[model samples]
Target: MSTVAVIGASGLLGRALVRELGTCAGWRIVPTAYRRVQGDTVALDIRDAAAVAAFVERVRPDAIVLAAAERRPDVCQHDPAAARALNVDAVRTVASAARQCGAWVLSISTDYVFDGSAPPYRIDDPPAPLNAYGLSKLDGERALLQSNPFGCVLRLPLLYGPVLDWSESAVTSLVPAVVASQAAGARPAPMDAWATRYPTYTPDVAYVIRAMLEQHAKGQAVCGIAQWSGDEPMTKFDIAVRIARALSIDARLEAQTASADATPRPRDCHLDSSQLDALGIGRRTPFDVAIGEVLSAWPAPTPSS
Candidate 1:
């Protein structure tokens, strides 16, 4: 009899969350989409406060998962205002509306909030974002917490899984590029080797969210911020090698130092999920296994004859 609304139901993580949560018994999943509508997902523009407030008021969901955000770091760098509008302002709007409706909010955040100086970050680590995207997300987290004291913030690292588009996720984006390079005999395509990333699977994240929601429904105190990361750390080059090996393609990828790039990024933002582990609410699927599952489900592009 409980209703849960998933905003940004069309994106990579959004879709996975909808799929995972929909399977749970005794829950009504209300999926909202913008720009793209799939199945019964309602179209929504979270940036429009009136529209969001109206939707939340109408749906009156018991819980709202704020999964939509302007996530691309480069995009945020180019237009910080746009990022703030969605990442920060919209979060406040949603949290405020959720508070009014007596609905708990769960906002998705990123590990980018930390600078590369730190290796594995804990829940209480002070955030020093290197990019506008990170700053905006951190702001969103603050807004969500301030607006709804009982709300939760889940910080995630690089994620990959069934994506609406191949280039949507940083992790899966490497697959198409490597595939193209192999077809064209382009050995050693330049990839970032300077920074390390913990690539998590979206399905695993969805599973964690479901578990947390179940606990909350059972009157468990699951509020506050928590981190979830993949089991291992790997550079972009390392990921490309794994992708190539998984697909039986040539592993021709070169390493490009991240520091050489003009844009600043966290060199290492591996998150510590010990808190989530202690709560017994999250699981970390191995990177290789997760990647293989994604590839099995992905409709890979065929090489031109």
Candidate 2:
């Protein structure tokens, strides 16, 4: 049976990857977590290059998925050192370790690498990151490829799915604001209506990764750059509206026509998922249906004392 080592198994997409690959026949999963290591999840700090190397030698899986990163845009802008530590340095560490152990690596990346001036970004499009987070991810992508010939980069757009809390994802985080706005005499909640986002489902991404792994097992490892994303585009206001609808609550949500985020964001960096589409490696759950599934598990807030 072939084995795959998944780093950052405690995070949103990482959990989904583990859950998806766990069901596949003839596969063994070695999941690692840094902050919340528990159960079968191994404790690993990717930033510690020596420890990472040691871990790789011990596990020696056939493939590795590097999913750990400091993804917050504002945080990245404020603390670039930390972002680089995880997104870039840690990526290099993982790729190097994987290469030495004869394992291929798949590193996660973001569409923010582009300036969002263009629509339907292809794999070949020149990246022009506007913020620290995007820049770090772009650098990390380069680091992975540079460190390992067998490494691949999968760039994704904004994501949402099974979340620990509404704050865990941008799409789900609007729930609190939506609920608060519905209260009598409450002020309208302002939401960004400028930047468009594609809230791809994490489980669907896990499914695609499993397909790539299946291909790798067949001696057809996917290398270099590839991308996958949800087809639907919606702004924060749009998503909030849907959340309100799902809850059957009429909420006051104001559309912010102009950009308000302190950190610079691209207007529409909609990644053209043609590469994965060509390989028939993709899954898309409609926003309405998928959002409902996410919200169902979330218990309503307790009333104020």
Candidate 3:
């Protein structure tokens, strides 16, 4: 039985990976958390190099799936040091430790690495991140590849599914706000129409990782960068309208042009998953079907009397 350590195991993506990977046979799953500790998940800060080294020495996992990072652009813009620490420095730490222990690494990255200037970016596209968050993640990717050439980098887009809080994911966060506006009689809440995004499902990402792991076990080369994004490219407003229609909510969503946010964001950093497709690694779930599934699992909004 091989052991797999999932850093940031309590996060939205981490939780989905844990749930999905747990079902696979012949693999022992070890979940590690930082702030929130839950069932059998060990607490360890990836930013601390010494601690990470020690943890890796102790567990000696066959693979380390790094799902932890400072994901929010606004937060990264406000505090770049923290972002660099978690996104870049921590990644280096994990990769270094994994390399020493002869463990393969699958680091989770984002589509933000590409400037929105180029739509439908390929795996080999030169990264020109538009924000601190993207830059940090790009740096992390470099660090991982530098430290462990045998490792894999999985670049993902906006993900949503099984979040502890609405704010945890970009897609799911819209639900509470839309519900609130509807309750307050605030019809047509402003939503961004300028920038386009692919709202990929978290479970789909987990499936991709599972496939990669299986390939690695079979001694298949799964190194370098691979992307998996949602098939449909829609703006936030488009997503809001779909959500409203799905739940039969009477909330009107006004389409507003994407403004100059504190952190400059790409207008359409859509990713091309041709590499993953070639490898037969993952499947794309339609956005409407995925959204309905997510909403069904989420807590229903309280009806206004």
List the global CA lDDT of all models. Answer: 0.88, 0.92, 0.88
Q: Per-residue lDDT tens digits of candidate 1, residues 57-159? A: 9999999998999989989999999999999999999999999998888999999999978778999989999999999999999999999987999999898
Q: Counting only residues 3 or more apart in sequence or on different chains, how many pairs clash (N, Cα, C under 3 Å) in candidate 1?
A: 1
Score every model by TM-score.
0.96, 0.98, 0.96
Enumerate residue pairs that collide in model 3: 188-252
Q: How far does residue 104 in candidate 1 sit from its true spot (Å)?
A: 0.8
**Considering lDDT, which of the candidate structures 1 and 2 is the better prediction for this target?**
2
Deviation from native of the Cα of residue 80 in model 2, angstroms: 0.6
> For residue 169, what is the lDDT in candidate 1?
92
Of the pair 1 and 2, which is ahead by TM-score? 2
**What residue runs in model 1 are displaced by over 4 Å at the alpha carbon?**
184-187, 258-260, 303-305
